[model samples]
Every structure is written in C-alpha cells, then in structure tokens.
Target chain A: MSQHAQDYTPSEREEHQAMHLLPVRRADLPFLISLALIAAVYIVLIVGILAAKVFYVELPLIGEVFTNPGYRYAVMLSLISCSVTTILSLWIAVPAAYLMTRVRFPGKRLVDAILDIPIVLPPLVIGLGLLMLFQTPPGAWIQQYVRFTYAIPGLILAQFMVSCAFATRSMMASFAEINPRQEQVAVTLGCSRSQAFWMVVLPEARRGMIPAATIAWARAMGEFGPVLVFAGTTRMRTEVMPTTIFLELQVGNLGMATAVAVVMLITSLVILVLMRVAGRGMRMM
Target chain B: MIEFQDVSIQLGSFALEHVQLHIPTGTYAVLMGRTGCGKTTLLEAACGLRPLQAGRIALMGRDVTDLPPGQRGVGLVPQDGALFTTMTVADHLGFALRVRKRPRKEILARVEELADWLGIRYLLPRKPHGLSGGERQRVAIGRAMAGHPDVLCLDEPFSALDEETHADMIALLRRVQRDTSVTVLHITHNRNEAQALGDHVHVLKDGVLERQDPKLWKK
Candidate 1:
C-alpha cells in the first residue's frame, strides 16, 4: 500500500497551527458534529444547486444558453452595470468610510445607523424606494435630465443602491485595520491632512479596498430584486442573467433556466478566482 | 523650542491634569517614565497630534496650541517607527518635499544628503518589509528630520534596537541634534538611554513632569 503513505505524521507547521487552536477532546464531539452539520448545510445549498443543474439538465442546452445572443447581451449589460456600479460605490464609499472612521460629530452614530438601513432593508424595498423617488416631483424633474426609472441608468441605480452599502461597510473595515498613528506621522513629516490621507492611509488600505470592490461587484452582478422592481425585466434592454433565468422558468423552460444558472455559477467562480489573484497581488505589494 | 503649559488631556483610561513641560532650543530632553505612564500621550499633545483640553503649546516661541500637526512645524517619530509599508526608504525620506511640491533636484539632493548622514543609502530603494528594527528606526528618524522641522519629537524610537545598535543610534541622534540644533523631546523607559543621549532629563510619573539633572539619570 505504498508504504502506508509515510505514516502521515503532522509537520512542524501543522503543529504550530494547532497551538493556536483550542484543545479537542472526546467531550467536544458534540460541538464538532454541530460545526460539521452547519458547514454541510452551507455547502449543500451552494454546491448542491450546481450539481443539480448538471445532472438534471442537458449539456447542449447549457452550451446553447452560454452562446445565446440574448443571453450574451444580458451578460454584457450585467458586466457593464455592475462594473459601473462598483466604481460609483467606491467613489462614495472610500470618502464616506474614511469620514466615518476618522471624524466625529453630533449624530455620528446615527449616521452610522443610517448607513445600515440599506443593508438591513430588503433588496426589493430598496428598488421600490428608488422607483418611488422618481415618482416624486423633484425626482421627476431631475429625471428629465438623468433618465433613471426603467432605463439602463435605473438598472445601475438599483444595483448601486443594493451594493454600495456592502462596499461602504467593507471599506470601513479596511480603513479601521490601519492604525491612526500612521496618518499622524505622515502629517508630522510635512504632509497636509489630505496629503497624509491620500499618500499614506489610502495606499495602506488597498488590501481592504480590493475585497470591498470585489464584494460590491459580485453583489451587483447577482442583484435581481432591485433590478427587477426598479429597472424592469425588459428583454434585451435590461434582462440580466438572474432575470433571464426567471423569464425562462416562467415559460417552463427548465433546461434553459438551468443553463442560465450554470452561467452565473461559472461567472461567480471566475470572479472568485480573480478576487483571489487580486488579494495575492495586494499581499505581494 | 517646545513648551507645554498646564496641559490637560484625557486619553482612554489615562488622564493628565495640569501637566507642565518645557524644552529649550537645541536641548536633547528625555522624558523617562514607567510603562503605562502618560509619556507618549504627553509627547503627542506637545506635537499637536493630540488635543489639549485646557492649555497652550508653544513651538519656537509662538503659540501653536490650535495648529494642526503639519502646520505646527513639529516632526514626530512614534514608537515602532510606524513606517508606511507601501513606501520605499527613499519615498519616506522625500515625502515631505514631494508634499510641498519642491523641485525634483532639490528633493533628490536633500534625500541623498540625509541617506548619507543616516548611513542608509543602501536602503533607499527597498521597502520596509525586509528591514530590521534598527534600519526601520533609522528610516523613521530620517523621515522626521527630512522636513527640516523646527522641533523633532521621538517616542521611544530606539527601544527596538540591540544594545550595540542602540548605542550607535544614541550617538547618531546626538550628532543630528548638534548638526541641526532642532529641539527634541524624547520619551523612553531606559535609564541608560536617557543617560547617554539626554542633555536635560525629566521624569513623568503620576501624570506630572519633574525635572532632573542628566547626571542623576543613571542613579
């Protein structure tokens, strides 16, 4: 049996890693079982769906959806909208997160609480709120110039509304990891307040920002509720991957819907790989 | 020159009330204190990095109680060097010059001059990740002095160095103080460090400054 795989002794690195972990015993079996069960629940939900799609659906149908012209446009639109939304979200989140971290004022805590409103609220409700805003007099007047409701801009707005909160939260966590003393030293070294922030704090926070942007992009890419409600599921105009799957399923096209789901799964995996690469690149820097 | 008159500030669980401290121009003053004493707090307040509730800070004989850190003309090297991990050693040295939009040639010359004086010319191109404690501290001191600051504040900058490196750093600091005549307010726990480098020594205990002659530092 190949020399019993060299006896499988733990390496020094493994022993060191185990040093940090709490001691395990027979009494911990129940806790370990519970942990395994919880992990299994999550794995089943994520992996099970992809497995089901491959097993129940025809391979040619999945391939056809992959190359479909309508599905292709949906993918392009989703990419464009999500990328734009991520950029806009970062533009707002970076400064907002920095302000939240550094500055204090009356109602600062309340402002923090308000930021969570978007995250806590249902995605569809956020979309409905955006739609309701355009129905208001000022929103309608502004709409004359900015085309927001049921338009491509509205689709981006919906994704941004849902994704920006996550972006801000992630960036805030990123900025928090940096010690405030770094900025103080930068200022003492003759950099102005803004200079210290831009040159020192921002560059140092890049690692955190990468995850923030990636999470926002992924959230935008997969966003359905807000886009459906605010942007509308217009064919070829606003139909994204999630909406495409919905429309196909409405007509009892199981194979088509499964194919669209597979596309999303593949795209998500690709994004995850890209995120890992970016994280590694950031660490190298 | 640096002066803190009746300075009062509360930081976390520590509080300083009616603390008075003064350092004359060109004097190498060390504030020695036990761990958890408000030594770094005092240093920060004096440098305009921390706000004082009720008192004034004067640098170079002018009131700077309300000035921001950059405008107060004070340079600070915090404990652990706090070097920007993203920057090369040269960038750290030239950061102040670049901020002020100084000429490229001038910035280069000043950085080169400092690198030579600090004996860190070899480290200019390298980032801080591979630097030893002594090298990091040297870079930190160089960065602080790069601005040609009116007053230089150092918070235990040499504590991380080995005994030999520590002694070398003390000599280097004394040489820098003599060459530039910049006022210095350093805080440290090491009595030997205070004895070797301080022209005037002070002890901070129970949130107050008590002046002592440098001769008594070893005792």
Candidate 2:
C-alpha cells in the first residue's frame, strides 16, 4: 500500500523517523558541487571587480572625487533623480499592476505589450526614440513648453521609462501571489472595492513594493547609454554619477573615473542592503 | 431566509446548472459536496461574489441578485479563515464598524463583545500569523458576526482542525448560530459534521443541489 504522510500511524511514524534521519546520498555530490562551483564563479567575479577598482585608484583620488564640486553635484543630481524616478514609478506601477491583476479589460494584452517595450528595447534605442519623438509635431509642441531633449528632465524620463516596467512587473507578481479571497471577505464584511484594496490588498503587498523600489533605484543608478544619448554629458548641468565616469575617462582621468564608479557601486550596495533589511522587518511584522 | 432560485453559474470549463437551495431564517444550513463539486462556487454566488448566468438570489425576502457583496448584507468566512495577515485580531473584529465610520466607543465596545464571546480576547493584540488554526476560525467567525450581518456564509470552516478541535468548533458554531439568530450557510464535505450542526443539510452532486436528511446519510 502507498503510504501518505497523514496516514502514518504511531508505529509507522516512529519508523518514519529513520526516513527523516537518512544520511545524505553519495550520488548528490556531483550535482551539488557543480552548482556551487558555478555560483562561486559569479560571486568571485563581483568581488574581484570591486577589489580591482579599489586597488587601481588611489585613496586620495577617491577623497578628491568626493570633494570636487562637479563630481559632488553629479552625485547629488543622481540621488535626487533616482529618488524622484522611484517615487513616480511606484505611483503609476502600484495602481497599474493592481488593475492589470484584478480587472479584466479590453486591449489588456495590447497595453501589456506596450508597457514591455521599454524593458525589451535597447538603452541607446530608447534614447534615440525619445530624441526622434521630440522632433515630431506633437512632441515638438510639448517640447516647446518643456525642453526634454538633452535636458535634466530627459534624465528622469529615461530612468522612469525603463524602471517603471520593472516596478510594474514586480508589483503584478506581488498582487498575483496574494489570495483574492481576503479582499472578497473584506467586501462581504461591508467594505467597498476601493476600501478593500486600500485596507487589505495594499497592506499585504507592502513587502513587494520594497523590491520594486530597490530594483527601480538600482536601474536608475546604473543607467548610462540612455542618459548619455538623450541627456548630454554637460558637467554641472545634466551630468549624473554614471556620466561622471564617462566624462572623467574622456579627460584621461582613469583614477577619478574608477573612484566615481566605486562610489556608485557602494551607494547601490548600501541601499540594496537597507531595503532588504526593511523588507525582512516587514515580513516579521 | 436565504434563497437561491434556479441559479446557473459558469466558470471556465466548470459549471453549476440550475442550483436551487433554501434555508429559513435562524437556521443552520450545511452544504456537503465532494472536492471540486462547486459547493464554494454556489456559496460565492449567494454572497454576490460570483455573478449568476441565470436566476436570482434572495436574502431576507429581498432580491439581492444585482447587489454588490457588501450591500447584500452577508458576512463571509472563506476557507482557512482568509484572515488579513497584517491586521491585529482586534482590527479584524472592528473592521466592519470602522469602515462604516461608527463611533470609536461603539467600535471598541463591539470589538470587546465579540472578542469575549469568541474567547479570543487575549488574542486581540496579535496578528493572524501566530494564531492557531482553530483560534483563527473563531476570530473569523467573530469578525463576520461583528457587522451583525443578516447572513453568514462559512466555506469549509472546520476541515483543517483535529478531531477534538473540530468537535469544539461544531459546538461553538451551533452556539453562535443560536445566540445570534443569524442565518448561516456552512459548506463542508464531512457527513458527520453535517449531522452534528445542521438544521437543514444539503448535498451537491453533478452540479445539482439536493436537500437531504442528515440522519439518513449513513444509508
């Protein structure tokens, strides 16, 4: 007879203690070791790159990069732009994802495909497209009032375009994982649809928003080809931290470039860690 | 009274055709069916969670077929309680009153009353994660009753409990239905449970509902 877990009696359960205590099989070694070796290569590569950057640049160059007005301004601008982009992305992503997950509407697949265009399009292509769009009549009309081509606003727009797709994807998965029955129960208990969303669904999705924001912030920080193509590398004008690396390299300042790169790397690492810790705390609660 | 008059529902490939059921006021109704037999789907239709393809549902003699789940004046305890993972037990108990913007004192009084009645007063400050399965169901029942709803729909409320816990829950549900005098439609697959608690027992088969005598279930 086939034995199920719940069907085990007291004597059978005692016998099953041996099943739980069984030693690791020798046949699993090759599979386990191969997977570990492949994983170790990626970890070592990341550690090696960080070590090379630290060693290639002098410590004082890192300090000088921080103290330099142009570089400092670039850092501030990058931070501000990334924060703003993350906020705006979340503002659109949360509602869009909730609707996409819960509500059935006409042209949903078409809308979904259009939203994924940014994620699939090459970074340079997005910048080129944005530039071309400005040249169009309607785009030109909007540009007349607000300059987006080769401006700071272009930097945010570029980041938001790419990052929002990722945020929306994360949020959609988050909402999908939550059981809709809770919201149904809430509605049956006198809450309207909007009230159930705000009270029940949103609270349960708090953990998901963390990863979405972190991914968006990281994407914004690392963005290069789009910002470089759309927004020019004008020092103290539209230059962000990523562009700082390009600009420093252009002037034969390799150490300064590596230092700026290191700063970006460390900033991203710190924020990722902080966000993960916050997510963990939320899960515990 | 709660009534499902010639209801027909289609969900993807699964369909419940011409389902009919009635439970008089202040009675405990038990719905029994095998797994995947559309018992929950039928319950959802009555609660306005699912739209019927044909026919209508009436609650307390009111035609509530087109009414939204909230406006239908029903409280649902979905499978495994479906308790809000983020809120405290007290928050769950006070949720309906709070949403209606009832007085803070009134909400607190109702919360206390339900908590004490459900014997979950000590669990008031804790969220659902730490709650035992039986305790969670009690809290769910308390929350459902907090709104003083005209009807309570319980979906497989005791399927997860041990024998002892299940017996306790049966007694508790009986007491709750008797004291509150609210109409209840409880779904379960266990025949013994139907015999233990039901005033009117039903069985679903081949997408049709049939009223059955619980005492004659053994035959």
Candidate 3:
C-alpha cells in the first residue's frame, strides 16, 4: 500500500487498471442467470423438503401394533415368504441367465421374448391371470398336484413370476458383458463346460449377479398387487408389509401406515446403498 | 504330425474350400495370407474350433475332425492372446496342466521355466491386463507350451508388438522351437515374418493356396 501510494493515488491507479484490463461483457449474462435460476429452484424443492421439520413425522407407539398377534404372524409370514422367493429366484434365475447367454438352441429368441412378458405385464393383470388359471378346470386339474389359488403357494408363485424376470434380465446383462471366448478357452485348456463356467465365467460375472439378486429381493419384498390378488390379503396369513400399510390406511390408521412406509423406505435405501457398493467393486474388478 | 486333407468350410459369407496342408513333426510352418483369406478359419478347422463341412483333420495319424478342441491335442494361441482375464500369468500358463491333473509343483516349475524363457519371469504374479502386448503374447505362448501339445498353432502372435519387440519375439520363438522340437503352424499376414520364421510358407489368397516358390524364402 505504501509503494502504491508513493507511485499513484487510488483513483489514478483504478483508471490505469481499467485502461489495461477490459470489463466483462454482457454476452454471458443469460447463461449465468439461467444457471442461478435452476440452482434456486433445486434448493427450494430438494433442500427445502430435506430441511423441513414438518416432513419428519414421528412414529406412534409400537406396543399396540406389536401386541396384535395377527400383525406379528403377518410379519413372520412376509419374512419367510420373501426369503423363500429370493432364494428360489436366485437358484432358477442364475441357471436361466447362464443358459440364455451362453447356449444356442432352437427357439432361443422365442424363450427370451416370453421371459420378458412378466416384466412388462401389469402385476394386477398377472395376478388375475394366475387367479383364472388356478381356479379353472384345466389349471385346477394341475392344481390338485400343487395348491395355488388363494394360498401361500399362489403368493410365492406370483412373486416368483414377477421377480424372476427381473433377476434374469439383470443377470443376463451381466453374463453378456463377460466374453464367452473366455469360457471357450478354459474348456479347450482342460476344464469341462460346467467347470469352466463355474471357475472362470461366474467369478468374473459375480459383481453383476449380486446386484441382480439384491434387486430381485427388493422387488419381492415390496410387491403388493400380485400378492394381494393371488394370495388374498388375509389378516394373519398372507399380509406382507405393503399389505399391512394398505390395510392400515383403509382402516384410517395414518400413523401406522406411515410407520410401515418409513420401514420400507429404510429397507430400500439400505439395499440401494449395498447395490452401489457392489457395482463399484464390480467396476474395479 | 498334423495334417489337413482337402478341408473346406463355409461360414456365412466367408469360405475355405479344398485346403490341403501338412506339418511334419518338429517343423515350424507358417500360413501366409491376406486379410479375409480364411487363415483363421483354417486354424480353427485344424484345432477343431470350427466344424469342417468336407475333408478330415488328422493329428498324429488319428482323425480328429469330429473331436473337440480339448481332445485334439493341439494348443492354440489366438490372435488377441485370449488369456483368461481373471487369472494371473502363472495361473494361465498352468491352466492345461491343472486341468490334466498334473502335480502343482511340476506345473509351477514348468510355468516358471517358460516364463523365464520368454523373459517374463517377473510378470508371473501379474494379471493379463497389467502386461504389455509383447508380454501378453509371451504368456500366451507359454500357456500353449505348458500343455505339452503335439502341435501349437500361433495366430499372428507378434502382430500386436512394435517392430523392435516383434524382431525380438521372432528370435525367441525360433530358439523355443529349436529347444522343444514342437511342431508349430504360425499364421501371419507379414511376408517378412513368414520368411524369417517359417521353414515352409503356404501363401493363401481368397481362401486358395498359391504355389510356393522355395527360392524366394531364404534361411
């Protein structure tokens, strides 16, 4: 400041700098204004909701809901059925994915198109179709061997039909990313077809498979329409978490419904985080 | 000895017809061809990777045309080095040995020996992605050699290497061939490589084998 004061007065120095350095033009003003507007809107919508204390609704007493033996049984049945659905979907989907990706057979494209039908069809329609099939004469004759209509088996079947397609689609993409030539090389080297697949292809595709499984599990856990129609939303029999939320909301128990929704949100968030981590590890591999 | 007697195949638009070739035991032969001339298909036919529509492939006087690649006793190093991405260099070299139920110690020793021979001993612990093109080719060759196959088919093994490295590789392969006495069918589009490495060169153009001029290729 002493050196500058000695050289020139503040006004003279400002004039000198202005003469050398050009002022910013107004050409970029529109872009900056648009960016600022977008940022403001985002902050008001996203940050405002997250920051608002009104959105934070507290849970009511759990004692009343837990005391009801029917709720407890419903929860237990949901956990068991969802777990079974996840396991069965994985077991069936893995092989289906592998075969669909690796093998060449007659009507391969037809089988692929058929597998896709479950994913695109409305779950309610799927449930209705299942209902008609299991209740009708030809389907009823088959049902004698295995109970399906309005039973636990029907719920599991509906869930499986809805979720297996999702699992297969994800796993198929994962399997496709892996080069089949790797498996061919392994087989030529000495491993049998199965051995080569298990050792070489599976390990490489494991990361993709994990997320597929997780997605399937998450979808199965949250499934409602099919389970309701196929298994019937019985109080202590086939009532899963979503069914519980629906039943509670119908009876005008807002607090309990919100609680179930919160639980579902937490579960979904945890699964999504796990999937992200798995996907990242897969990329590193 | 490996022999192809009037072998022919048609894959979509590409075709290889009436191809007859022979490789005497312990001699290194090169298949010289331009692109789209069905050189790779010939190799595939010889290795049992592709089915032959006509004619037969005989390995050590046994008809192996219908046999699978594993049962053909022929090792193939594909053009891209095709090393298993999930396995380490040592694991790849020892793959066939492990599949054949060889002892772990023996497999390790052979892998180390081949790795050292190829000047890639230090790279044994690394994965294929960590290797240079030359190093990958070395590992592919080592893996093929590890199987102790009757014949080795190298499909443009040095094509990906730089000129200097390619020269070095040619010398290395010659030494390896002299030592092992393993019959090799080296496929390449480069005329210099064919002349340098081949004891006999079969020139292929548009899937047809041209008459060879023995005097054109010198030692």
Model 1 residue A223 CA deviation in Å: 1.1
DockQ (Cα-based) per candidate?
0.39, 0.49, 0.19
Point to the candidate with the largest DockQ. 2
Over B44-94, each residue of candidate 3 has an lDDT whose tens digit, in order, gives 788777778899999878898888788878777877777776678889888
lDDT of 3 by residue, A152-235 (tens): 888888888888889899889878777665676676676778888877888776766677778787888888888888889888
Better of 2 and 3 by DockQ: 2
Supply the global lDDT for candidate 2: 0.88
Candidate 1 C-alpha lDDT tens digits along B1-219: 888889899978868999888889889999998888889888888777788889888999999998877888888888878888788999999988888899999999999999999999999999876687788888989998998998889998877778888888888999999999999998898888888888889998888788988785446
Report, for all candidates in order, the number of backbone clashes. Answer: 0, 0, 0
Worst 10 residues of 3 chain B by lDDT: B210-219
What range of 10 consecutive residues in model 3 chain A has the weakest lDDT sum? Answer: A1-10
User: What is candidate 2's CAPRI-style docking category based on DockQ?
Assistant: medium
Best by TM-score: 2
TM-score of each: 0.90, 0.93, 0.82
Candidates ranked by TM-score, best first?
Answer: 2, 1, 3
**Deviation in angstroms for A194 in model 2?**
0.8
Estimate, for each residue in A71-182, the C-alpha lDDT of model 1 and write its tens digit.
Answer: 8888788778888999999999999999999877799999999999988999989999999999999999999999988889999999998789999999998787676878
Tens-digit lDDT track of model 2 for A17-135: 97788566789889878999999999999899989987887788778767989889999999999999999999999999999999889999999998899899999999888888889
